[model samples]
Target chain A: MRTTHVGSYPKIPDLPAPGRWRTAAEKLQRGEITREEFRRVEDEVTREAIADQVGAGLDMVTDGQIRWEDPQTYFARRMDGFSIDGLQRWFDTNVYYRQPVAQGRVAWREPVTVEDYRFARSHSPRPVRPVVTGPYTLARLSQNRYYPRFSDFVLDVAQALNRELRALDAESPPLIQVDEPAILQHKEDLALFREAAAALLEGVRAPVALYTYFGDARGVVRVFYELPVEVVGLDFVAGVRNWEVLESEGFPQDRRLGFGVVDARNTRLETVDEVLRALDRVSRFVPLDRVDLGPTAGLEFLPRRAAKAKLVRIAEVKRAALEVTR
Target chain B: MNGLPLFPTTTVGSFPKPPYLLEARRKRLRGQIEPEQLRQLEEQATREWIQRQEELGLDVFVDGEMYRGDMVAYFADEMEGFAIAGLVRSYGNRYYPKPVVVGPVGRRRPITVEWFRFAQSLTGKPVKGMLTGPYTIAEWSFNEYYPTRRELVLELARAIHEEAVDLERAGARFIQIDEPAIHTRPDEDFDLAREAMEIVTDGLSAYTITHVCYGDVPRIYPRMLDLPVHQIDLALKNEDFALLEVFRQHRFTKDIGLGVIDAHSHRVETAEEVLDGIRRSLEVFEPRQVYVSPDCGLKTRTIDETVGKLAAMVEGARRAREELGAG
Candidate 1:
């Protein structure tokens, strides 16, 4: 449950670079702007945020989730068989482009888009995580709209994304991170999550780090240990005891383990020493090369300034801690 | 005695305590004032809140949660097997380190009656017996103990259920279980949440209600159709009124506590806007199943804003009733 040495955090010091538009998202519900207009603003704002993170100096950098509407939303847009009609009111905490439960057979109406993602990759020479909402998470979260079974819809969406990821693989850097935040919602879904995960990820050749946030991984920490995935991410903030489960459940030592000790949703910054203490504890489970670092969840919920400031500290402290301690 | 109509219009449950009462309660908890004195102060605040709503001609009123602690923390303490960790600095000096849920909860004593009685005693209005729903209590706590999140919630639900029966036995007629956490449910787990909810609220005798906001109604839809609660108090003011058509399609039969006022906003909503909201609600929901209320709670709002908005909501409901010839 504790890190013995320096571990990974979304130590990335940048945000998404400035750019332009494509799909619809939950932002449309907020009436902040039209979907097309939002795409452009977000693309650019994302660059600014990433620049800010890079300016701060940290380890790995992502487009700060610049390409998609939400983790699951952009993926939904790529495929067409599902209708946006059945989604319950947008999400309760964070909004997403949700599809309602149908016959569970998920089909894509449109070809998944990726130009803006390549645009994000173009932002810097730094190692960036090409983020994709995991196919299992996407299918699991969306309503099939017409499908009869959850797995059927989930697997279909997963297979399509595998194709997308494989294409993404042909074009860009090989690292693709799949966010499966919903996996923590229940225990029963852990095995099913692994199964569905294995499917969507079947053809992709990149190193995959499956991520879950906001709650405990108590149910499926074991499935994660055995899954064919290259890495696994666990939330350590609100999910106060997920680490204990991981320790008890036993994850593979060779696979990369993403330790999320930073509080992404809250504004208060933890002292460098405090974070180092957490990192040190996580290191106990895996060596530095086998661990990645990041917040417990997305940096979206925190006010932009707070999130930026937090990343600043994360980047700085990580450099000092890793250099001296490791 | 049954005190109110099913799924009545009321606050989600916190009221800003008058400075003096808050000071006194702090003093009382610190062993300064006697329980009787604290009781008097709560009753006084409850009287004022009730009178304010009565003056607005509200059909049902709450004592504005004059007696409970902060909504999430109160229930967090009663949860079973949680090690009350020493305070973790949350935001500021207002230190509230939650108890880690390490095991199952078995309620040993009553938690919210003294204030419910004091409020009901002072008013002729029907008072709401409010409690935080299970899903919320689990979500708000450090969920470290349970084998799974669902089991953790079911334990909390059973505990809340015991409280509901106690309130009903103690002359309470209506109950509202606030569940803003439903908004946080993963898009895929709506039915899992509903399943847990049904188990927790299985046998409550009074009209049970759930208040949640800001999610696609469909995430909870059709699935919510099966919950044990008789009514759903939801937020609608921030979104366009047309967003409500989904509920109509589902033929949701439960009473709907239509939030005519946006709780997150402080600007006093005009009567016309309020009426438009009520009208929009009526377009989709039958009048009998509709009860006018704020989208969420008033804790984040000022006293004046709360009063002003409630007044606006009541006036709008009256207009709708008259226009429909149901008055």
Candidate 2:
């Protein structure tokens, strides 16, 4: 089994002093430092994040999303026809994201995350997966003033993001992850999500993983499997009902399973036996080799130390699973 | 209520602590300073904030919540059956030690009453007793003990009920229980929030207020009025008072703590802007039904920003009252 991060590692390292990234960000806001100077500090932290993932023995890693303010604004700020607005709570967590307001038909201006992916790929020994906040989630989370219908807005966002995905695909990364945690909240939007997903992955040549978290995707699991993606990631911790759905309906053998066994939202670490038990159950349908073990959601919800420890635990689980299989 | 002005001005609790107090808090956390030393500084900061409010000509006052950290964690730290956990992100570049409920939760004693009494003693104006609502405490915490959220919330409601009663006994005229997490899951959890609030506000003599900010306000608009409180404080300025349209559609049933200044922005609002906000609010709410305040807590802003925002808010309220011929 391979181990990987869903997306987003903690920005701050386990340090006594305030993190340099935070300090530099404040300095940049205050005009005390140039944008170039602040970006250098961000680059340093990005390197550290990739190193952290590599040190934990993950097969695939990311840039840790250290430079991102939050998932929504990171893409919304870069794209056209959107304005970043006030802070809104992100799901049930204590964390908040700046809500994106769509003023007109959304369109992709240029590649947003390609350079970051290149930076991560250059710095890491492990394969780096470029993660994009999915169009369905972007449309769901945003306030739309331009579109007459919600479907129109979502499809437009999907068409816009398809360009970004094509750009990332050109990099020839291991896999691309599209996060649509908002889908589980609105199950009826599956058809619309399918339309958007189709548009988003239209010309992308790289293998893609569609990941959902924060809640169960039992209602949309079948629809999720129907998508033209190589992998389907679901949260087994917060989205426990996905387990029941998996046991009853069974997973498609053709698609790889992104087994999210680690709880990224909570500080509690899972033991090897606990992870092994879950692996045994999931391995019934999807073979162990075809599964990617990782946390349920982004590790940004956790402290740096706990997030690192969780990563180490996932690596340990992978080793233990290998031993059990042997 | 009769003693208040036409457009009564107040804060939604929490002002930015001075640099020395922030340093003292840090020292106290590292065990470099005694509890009494920290308490003294907290008192000093509270006194200064109360004096500042009086000078700014606000009708009502809050103790500024200088002795607290995260609103949920503060009560969790004082109450039984809770252990503070590792850092969790609250927002952009903001983290707080999340509280985990480990056992049967109970309040050993009044959490904010002593702070309320201290602040009240320093001022002649009525100081609002501030407490984080039970729904918020339960929603924000990691519950390991309670089988259901309702049970834990009700237990917390009972615990906060004790605190509210004590604050009323200590001569608090207004008690603001903040439930910022109420609107997070409006479909499933809103009723539970109202039930828990009823348990806290039942038979309490103090004018009750619930402060909710930065969530799906439109989703829970008229239904939020079902919350058993005398007033609902909202972050209206940040949303450009767009909620007024909803209020106009479904008549607002309770007093509104009209947010006239944006608390999160570093740029201080002009008095004209604040006045414009107050004027827009008056279109939907009567002057007496409106209470002027900042959008939310001022702890996120610097001391200068907080002062500038509040000064502008007070000036705008003054101008609004004059226009209404009630100054």
Candidate 3:
């Protein structure tokens, strides 16, 4: 079994004096630090974030998205014709994001996430996966004043994000992950989401993983199987109803299953024995070779220390699961 | 409810933070400025919002929550046995420090009363004392110390009761307890949240109001009626006046804070649109029971949009009053 994480690792604590990238970004806004200084800090923290996952014994890794203010708005800020405005609540969570406001025609001006992925690759011996905020999620979370229809906005975002995906694919990472947390909430728009998602994954050379969390995806799990992706990740921790889908053989047998057993939102630690048991239940339906064990969502909700500890246990559990299957 | 006008116009809570005030907050965070400097800035923002509400001819006004950072975190910072956690995602990319209950939750001092006094001192018009309800605080936070969610919420309820009573003693005639979290998990936790809310508002002498925003109200009704509040405020306009049917079906006995303005949108509601919403709500609620307001807090909107929306709301309420033949 392979070990991986959903995406975000908790921010590396600034020991001695405590702060994160948010504090640094504030300083940059106030002109207290030069652009060069800010980039240096971002690069330094990104390295620490990567090390957090790599040191925890993971086969595939991410840059921990340290520089991102939030998943959606960070990309929105970097893209053209999209402005970050107003802190809208992210789903029902206490965290907020600057709502991505579509001001004009959406287009990709330059690479948004490629450089960060390259930075992570340069530092780590393990393969670093590039995680992009999926087009459907970006469209759903945004305030679309310019688009005539919501689908028009989703398509434009798909076209824009496709360029970023192709750029990252040029580097030939083992996998490219597109996060679609909004898909679980919009089951009625499954047909629309599939079209938008297909547009996003088109012409990508690397294997694509479409990840969903924050709610159950059992209602629309069948829709994801038909999409042109190699991996489908479901949050078993939050999406408890997904187990029935698994039992009913709803998951596609041809693709890799990122089976999430660890609860990322809560701080409690899951023991290796417990995680192995969950994997055993998953192994009944899916082949062990096609299964990747990981957390239900990003680990940002927990403290850095707690998140790291969770990953360490997950890695140990993955090893134990592999031994059992072998 | 006494001496209130027919279809009284007010805000749920909060107004937009201008660019300067946002900068001041950042400065205060970096220790570049003193707390006194930040207080001066907050005072200036509060005065501007109060003056704007007065100019717009609003019946009940709020201080716009100029001194608060996040709704739940602000109270947690003031209370004992609660510590602010690292930034957790509430939605999209907007983050707030989730409060962690480390010990018994209790109020050490008054949080919003002084700010209430300052804003009430400025205007002859009554300013509603706004607070984040205990259920919302307990729901949004991560409790490590408490044994059960119900216990923690009730503990938070006791702390919040202290703040509500303090606001009353500070001469606040109208107090709005914001419980935006009640909209989530209605099937399992609705009764628990309602019970906690009753604990917060029980025995309060002020004219009590509860604002539940960005939610489906019809699902939580009957249970919502048991909140022990004098008024139940909801974002009716955002629902496109669908809540009128609920009000009509259930027959609201208490006052209704009808939200006629959409706070999440950049498009300012025309006075006609606001008037239509108020008229539709009046079909279900009595004119004396109607309190016209926005769907939620105005903090997410631009300052210009906030002012324009409030002006339109007041104008619409005036039109509704004229049409109904009630002054």
Candidate 4:
């Protein structure tokens, strides 16, 4: 029952300033470098990033999503139709990533690599919140070049993820976080989101978490509360105005609040006082344990050094949270 | 001529670039398609459009944005601190790039100079040099890096003015700088915009036109008229006419491009109604000083509707011409 960022950090190679993660992955896959060598590199990157979060005094830690790409199919080996394609534009900016798409039906390209899910669990020592791209967001992002309705496709995606989450739950992961960033953009389609949320966590045995970032809930958090989710996440940065809407419209008491106060898009590091103030105000409505202090979105939008700095700040806020709790 | 009636019309930009032609432009960019073949495709559309305009006897001939790839997308290649990652699928799966303003922007060289020169060459009638204004570019960008949005706009203004002077050198008598995003910011930026306008039209010749529409004109109109542009094309089709009094108050020295045609709706405005809109303009502008053109670029519109609307606009002007002579 906690919060985290969308999982997957591009593992940096030991060599001074590697070209891209793919080139490093290729060297390993081609047998030019041993798997142990690749693991060491990823291990260094993740351990340093996780320690930064822990040092920042963050209550929860994500492996900085260092080794995941798109994350929808990182671990699921069996699915109806899905695979990685040639590099395409992610939001049509200067940066490019190899895009994942649904080839036929919504299914997994591979099994959930339980390594990061397990590694994060082991790495945090403190409670680690497992973050995955939500089924609905994945369905909406991937083209319907094959799948018909995104709702139907997301249902299949959610179903496949259930197996992964259940396996993580059996391994005793504390929380599973679903990254539904696309919901803010598709505010008008609330029913589809509710249905999609219900579908993804359908059989997940773990305490389920869902995070929405980058925009306002359109004051539509009311519709979201109706989902069978235990904790609902929102980006307080953009959704500041929507809080009033949440106050006016009632929320389900069964759900916890994952309040996103840190801004992931910008490089500015937040202080302990600012994080404490947000935690205090958000805690007034939800119980102290029900709220997690974290950034509004993923650190992927920032450069590696800045991203690490922000996570360090997250840990600081978590310490502030403990002080408030005591 | 000063006492004679004035006419103005407009169309939204981004005329339908068929996939074949779009691919051809991409090919040209990649060095696959020859400049001649690309010219042939654009020229094919341009020549036909001008012929239709002349046949209809429209006063100014717009080349219908035949050569430019996308209104905002074209800037991605020219500017720094930004990169075209991928397209934004909005308004029903129409993809446009999310122009991430990852840093500050600067110009590389002239973007629209060659095509505008080519367009001007095809028609004997006066040609309209089309440019997307800096404010629009700034508004459309993510602009997260800038300390203030105004700085980014001013930076864009410098870049826009660079191309505008080039277009003027390329034989552009009428440069229509599009500023549909001007009003989106707060009211305080208007003065800054006025200063930027002076910079954009700084070395330009006569007949600098600023195309603006779909916002409160009373606040924007007077501030805009104070700029260096010779004519202001205002959206009158879906706006209040009371603001025309602001121009009447200034004894407006610059001409007005009164958008008598409704570009938003598909229903073609009747020639009589468009003429009626012109009669209303007579109250503000002296006849010769008034010009007729679309409210904006015809880019999003279908080719047939553009021609039909332009033909209707001309027919309305013919009516205005006949009525003014009689009056």
Candidate DockQ values, in order, are: 0.08, 0.49, 0.22, 0.04
Native-referenced DockQ of model 4: 0.04
> Over 4 Å off in model 1, which ranges?
A1-289, A292-326, B1-9, B22-39, B78-80, B83-97, B186-189
* TM-score to native of every candidate shown: 0.57, 0.92, 0.75, 0.54
Which lDDT value does model 3 have at A225?
Answer: 85
Considering lDDT, where higher is better, how would the candidates rank from best to worst?
Answer: 2, 3, 4, 1
**Second chain TM-score, each model:** 0.87, 0.98, 0.97, 0.85
Judging by lDDT, tell me the better candidate of 1 and 2. Answer: 2
What is the Cα-based lDDT of residue B195 in candidate 3?
A: 85
Could you tell me how far off, in angstroms, the CA of residue B236 lies in candidate 1 after the best superposition?
0.7
lDDT of 2 by residue, A1-326 (tens): 78998888877765475678777777888899999998899899999999999999998988999878998999999999999887888888778899999998799999999999999899999999989999999999999999999999999999999999999989999899999999999889999999999999998899999999878877789988898999999899878888898987799989999999798876667788999999999988899889999999889877788799999999999988788778
Q: After superposition, how far is residue B74 of candidate 2 from its true place, in Å?
A: 2.2
Residue B303 of candidate 3: its Cα lDDT? 90
Cα lDDT of model 4 by residue, B129-178, tens digit:
77888877776555557877678888888988888888888887778787
Clashing pairs in 2: none
Residue-wise lDDT of candidate 1 within A1-326, one digit each (tens)? 21211111221122232112211233455576776776676667567656766676645667766454345556665565654432233223422344533443455454354565576668855666666777666766665556556666667777777777776677655467777776776557665677777876777777777787777788678777777778788888867787788678766876887777877655457788888787777777777657676676666544455566677777766676768765
Task: Estimate, for each residue in A14-68, the C-alpha lDDT of model 3 and write its tens digit.
Answer: 2334555656677888899998888888888888887888899988888888777
Where is model 2 chain B poorest over a 10-residue stretch in terms of lDDT?
B85-94
Which candidate leads in DockQ? 2
- What is candidate 3's CAPRI-style docking category based on DockQ? incorrect
